[model samples]
Target: MKQFWIVGLGLLPLVAGCSLFETNPVPPSPALTGVSAQDAAWKDQIKRVRGAEEARFEPLVEAREAVSAALAQQGVNDYDAASLEEAQQALDAAESGWAEVANKRRPNGDKLAAIATDAHRATRLAEIARYAAVREINLEKLVAVNDQLETREQSQPTRQARPVTGDARDLVGQKVVPDQLGEVSFQPGTARMKPASQEIVRQLAGLLERYPSVGVAVFGHTDNVGPSAASLERFVKANPKLEQQAPSQAEKVRAFNLALSAARARTVAQLLVDNGVPARRIGARGFGDTRPVASNDTQAGRQANRRIEAVIVPGPDSPEAQRARAENAGS
Candidate 1:
């Protein structure tokens, strides 16, 4: 027993020495410790993204953020792998554009334009993946509902073909609104629809077609950025009767944002109309930056704030529908 204790005590110093040696291994040579090209490129990208955000390069920052948000979404990769892959490809293209621009320290206007175009494409593709994922999730819920109905029908004969009334109707309506609408990006400072936004419009149209009774209230919102003079002039021209009550620059900016948001909402509504959704069942409005789902302090939050959301109204009795009716009557 004494020998065993002595041996254990002797081994303690050996274990301590091994740990010390492991923790203090000789540092690699400077050449060997250098980052690989790939690693350096990745670091450059990180810096670029941060710099873009700081410089308020909306297109590049938004593209980077959108792709990241889409990829991070739950089940996005699994449910919409094709769109997700396309998004990645577009992002890669954007990254390549950045790298090309980096080589030309003073990129010309054309090269800068090309980079912006690539970034916009990346943002659109990422939005497509995100919207597709949301649609897939909604479709799965609908399929589950169908399965539940089938099970009930098999258990009882009378409950079959009951027209999806009551709770089921509410469930479908609730699930139909793509909650990720806040991530649906648009062209910078324009009502023009991105390719991915078109997908969202088509999906909304299909839902309206499938459930004729379901009405949608489309609401547009904007970030806190004040409108340009040209935009404010356009707004004032279009909304002569709804002119600003106060002449404060802030108030005018608010009015401009409201009008711009409304125009964007109308653009989406027009797309729905073209897609065969009845105009009567659709009510479009704008809240400007009033109802932000996220902070407007950061680029990511601002992107989220600048969005168009669609609220599904199940029936005439719904408060949303009633409010729409009231607004129309007043107008």
Candidate 2:
């Protein structure tokens, strides 16, 4: 049997087995223009990093990830600790200026601008360092390696790629417009779906079962009533009969609105799985009131906001895809 393993990241391979790991070159961060990496800021950072013509691709991409991690608090910034440290200094200055404002003093805008410029330069230098480290420091080795590459390129021209059949559209993954199960909703202050919502997802779950390659994403939302933690607390207090069967601790609610949103999303995801959708293909998240479709002050508007929306994320067939596939296979 072909296995589809899901790791902690919630992303898995669209296909299984050795069709993955085919001799593909890791061309760089253009590797993910996919749904998950669609943020404008992320694309801008990637473009700036990949613009280094003189540097090898791997080192530049690796360095970009290092800066990203340090800023995001995910891991250590071993690529350029000093630049990362300097960037942090800018943040410290901004924080200090804000503190002065609390004391009735003028806030410093210069420090904030400096932070932006400093971060940009740091990221650029991180990419440039890859080329400088090899070419400027080890001139003899660089020249020797260049000579070998030039000779090879001259003697053997690049081969033409094999042509694929059908239209170009057929080769890429399809992204369908998300069907939002119109008027679907949850009971007030709880994750329990009304009957209409259940019927809609049941049909969607069947469609997902029919299309194994299509991926489903569930985003939970709230009506801006309050934070998710507080909302969840209120729900627990009011609905003691249902609290016993509630989902496990999220550990990181921070606020109640988000907590309620998450609970609703998990509820929807579970319902879909029970209906027929494969668990591995479903990814869930809570948007709270951040992405409200209507104003929260009105009852109708609040009702609209308190709903779940699902999208079918298209799979990207790239080096990253292959790596994800490899990781899934291993898992």
Candidate 3:
């Protein structure tokens, strides 16, 4: 019986072979040739992305440098590993985002180009944000350390021996201190400081030298006579008033007036710096016809208003203020 059952076994093997032959082979997709139109488009996109990324690298590098400097200054000695990890993570994320966009096929190349441009901007902003975080963290650590030091100093005997002064310090926060006299005149328009006013600058410099730690602010002022913006423009130009134009043309006249005032302030600052005063100890600002000490309508008042002033800042001992007071007393 067993021998008889083997009769159809050969046919079964034949059926198995047929089944194997009938199995479907995978159909090949189009090959990615370098010279194809699609490849050209892809290359263009890559170029755009690469160009944008390259442009952003400089600012990113600067931000990173600033962060590194701040961290070092803050005494963050143990942050090397953490800093490296953060930088690597940022790079990885940027690369991954760029790759994802680069691999995509867009029907509108212009749109993708625009997107690449925006992505570059985004990356720059991200770098700034990241560096800002680093700075903030480092600053916090610095403040903490400083506070600790201050506390320790306060607990020491030296701090107890040194008595603190009760007088309030006069610290102006980046404000432009206007001249005591509102403005100066140079024959309706000119850069030259008036001969009579030259002594004023000499006096101011003498005052400044007495206070090495104090900073002075020299501000110029003018009378209102024209469109504010136009007057400011003309003032910067320092152009003289045209003889053909009426002197009553307040705008033109005021432009000359303010220009003279600004020149006076600059001259005073230069004189101070030239006399061994550090340049950082002085700041110059110009306000064209904005703040008037006297009425412009009256000739006497206007004459009084058109003048140069010197603001003497007192130093740690306010030596300049004291000297100024002594000179005033002597006068």
Candidate 4:
């Protein structure tokens, strides 16, 4: 009876209603949608990037970051549109190369080399774009400041014209080069004016005192000589155009010279103030090694380059303007 029961149980699976021997088909995987689909794509990209990085194509990663950083900065596209566009194209090429390499079981060495070259170029261009953008922004600020100064000058009350004579006559109508008026000298590299410079300063102060309505702009300049490495680096970082045009020390020296020239201008302006010239009538600035009257290759030329210039701008009621008006009236 027990054996008959066992046989019956074994035959049960063969019966139509029994499901023990039949296998169940797995349900189709749910279609990926929304966040899951996006997540999958991101994971795939991450895997490819990881593969690229492991294959020693890290420069591409750096280039991508650099391009992204440049785009993030203000006015990059506006100031350096050409460089930015080129950088983007180079980066795209590098990335495409990387994708092709990553997809293959074995990456070609020549293709990897090309990708690296493109990545390096993209990085350099991106850096240049950022530098140009910042420089243009600074220049715009300077122009705005100059406009404000002009506005302030226009707001001042008109004064009666005064008589001009001697040194004042020579200076009032033109940009007075300090070398023409007994060169303004400084003590070594310092901003302190030497005793020899006193005569020039006195001459300028006297001219300003004679015509109170006349405004003077003092410009100081220097030769290309001494500059610290750090300062040079900073200058290169700030002025990419300069570095691109003149990579030598001649251009880098401007970084140090700029500060020295500014100080010298201020010193001269201060001296004029001490000699009774109104501070309001004076504006001081520096040109560094940019505007050289002579070549910096020679000592005399460098000495000529390192000097102060005063530009006297006569107001509507100034002596020079009055002289012009009187001459016109007589004619």
Residue 275, candidate 3: how far off, in angstroms? 2.3
In model 4, which runs have C-alpha deviations exceeding 4 angstroms?
1-171, 177-180, 227-252, 315-331
lDDT per residue, candidate 4, 103-222, as tens digits?
565555567667767887888888778756654553344334434543554577962222345553343434454424657889866798889788788987876666665656577889
Ranking 3 against 4 by TM-score, winner: 4
- Judged by lDDT, which candidate is best? 4
Reference-based lDDT, each prediction: 0.58, 0.47, 0.42, 0.62
Candidate 3's residue-wise lDDT over 1-331, tens digit each? 1122122111111111111112122222223444455444433544334545432322223334534443443223332334434544454444444445544544244433334343444334333334334333422332243335435645777622211112213321111122332233444434466665555555555545543544554555655554455655555455444544444465565656565566666666676666666554554444567556679898877665555444333232344334534653585
How big is the positional error of residue 92 in model 4, measured in Å on the Cα after superposition? 44
Q: How far is candidate 4 from the true structure (C-alpha RMSD, Å)?
A: 31.7
lDDT of 2 by residue, 1-331 (tens): 0011122112323211111111122223333355434333232332323454322222233444544545653122433345456645544443443344323322233432333344444454433332222212222222233235335535766733222223322322211212333545777767788887788778667656555555555667787775366655665566565566564444223245676787887787788778866565555566677666678789999877777766443223433345665774696
In order of appearance, the predictions have TM-scores of 0.42, 0.39, 0.36, 0.41
Q: How many pairs of residues collide in model 3?
A: 3
Pairs that collide, model 3: 183-306, 183-307, 222-289
lDDT of 1: 0.58
Please give the lDDT score at residue 167 for candidate 4.
51
List residue ranges in candidate 1 displaced over 4 A: 1-168, 171-183, 233-246, 315-331
As a TM-score, model 1 comes out at 0.42
